[model samples]
Target: MEITTLASTWPAALTDPSGRRQLKPRTKGRTMVIDKGIGLHAFTDLLATSGEYIDIIKFGFGTSPLYPLPVLKNKIELAANQGITVIPGGTLLEAAVRLDMVPGFFRQVLALGFTGVEVSDGTINLSRGLRNDLIKDAKSLGLTVFTEYGKKLFGSRIDVDDFANTAEQDWSCGAELVTVEARESGKGVGLFDERGDCRDDDLSHIRSVIPNLSRVLWEAPLKEQQVSLIKTLGPDVHLGNIPVHDVITLESMRRGLRSDTFELQQVPFLEYMI
Candidate 1:
């Protein structure tokens, strides 16, 4: 079976409302989708529809090991071919740590053609030294490492100073970026409050300490959260944990094609150059 990408059929100037949005091989404005067991056809449909807009596809929360080997390989290969980095969720690495199977996990991931790995301790208690070591190990294996800060439990919130410290070490140790844990629901954990609203103060504090906001990926799966973050961080903030069906919708919002951000890129002063 063959598949096609939207970019092949559409003209770039006509597709993007905001002409300033960067093309893929992009550093900023990355969108990472969470794949929680969508089948091969659906995955193909997603790439065919919005692959150019997607930067990463995370096989969520220990589910990478659940797929049939062929399906998993196909998913990774397909995403790779489209320039998307495919990674198993951080929780899978935490599980391996608990089972003393870290070596095997890295071995299997490389063998399976994953381009990256997420190293997190949302559930397990990992020491700072161990976390850095894990980051280094992944780097040595030639896999991009995405570290995570904050616990996965409900009511867990960001400690700005601690997050700054960890992010510094993670990046120094060679992590590609650090993700704030909002889980799949985008509620009651990390950046979100019980009602799913962002804790804006926490975000501000984190930003104050972290020199580069581009190195942070906010796991915002809800539409409202996406809009708020984009409005706050502008259209280029790295967002993760997006649902499969919402890929195009999220891409539309990112490019200011959606009403919520339609005028986001308009610089009124630029129109009146004297």
Candidate 2:
């Protein structure tokens, strides 16, 4: 299918009304899509269509190892050329740590043209010292390290103090951002309840306690969670685990072009700013 051009005349928020979000090249309110083994052609199509709205792309799980070397390199380069960062999933890092292959993983990531890496222990146990060392090492290698907070098990719960402590440590050690862990399914883990809804009370409480909400990327893969989060935290809340297809759709929701948020269409973009 042919891609549609985003002509400037399209009324800034006609599609994504959250016009306040600092578009491309911005650090805040970033939209990251998870790449779950989409082929090269489709991947190219996705970038061609929604590249403007995307900031980061994670090759979900250990799929990085599954891809042929040439294919992976091409994918990474293609994404980077469009000003979109390509990063290995955090779970992949956990596998590296498990196999004592952190160095190897870092080397391969750069060699394959990936611009970023995520250091996470959502499935494994990692001490603060090791996590900090990994963050420092990745940063030293010029890799944009996005650390993750929380476990991947079903019904995994988050303690505000623990998450806050981890966020502070990761940021202090030069991590670009900290991810709130929500496995790809977005269900029964991290912030989401068994039904995959963003637990408002939990989210509110965590927000109240965390000193830096901007540093934490909420893993909201569901549309409802995204809407609720953007509404509660305003349009600029950094969100992660968005589906590849919903990249532009989520962008629309953020910009207030979607039906759910169209009611706020009259408000000025500046009013949504912090």
Q: In lDDT terms, which candidate is top?
A: 1
TM-score of each: 0.92, 0.91
Q: Summarize candidate 2's per-residue lDDT along 1-274 as a digit string, tens digits.
A: 9858876576654644544778579778898999999999999999899998889999998899999888889989988998887899988989999999988988898889889899998889998899999999989988898999888889898887888888888999999888998888889988889998878888888878884687778889999888888888877888888999999888777777888767646666465556
Each prediction's number of clashing residue pairs: 0, 8
Query: Stretches of candidate 2 above 4 Å error?
Result: 1-8, 13-17, 267-274
Off by over 4 Å in 1: 1-13, 267-274
State the TM-score for model 1: 0.92
RMSD (Å) per prediction:
5.1, 5.2
In terms of TM-score, which candidate is strongest?
A: 1
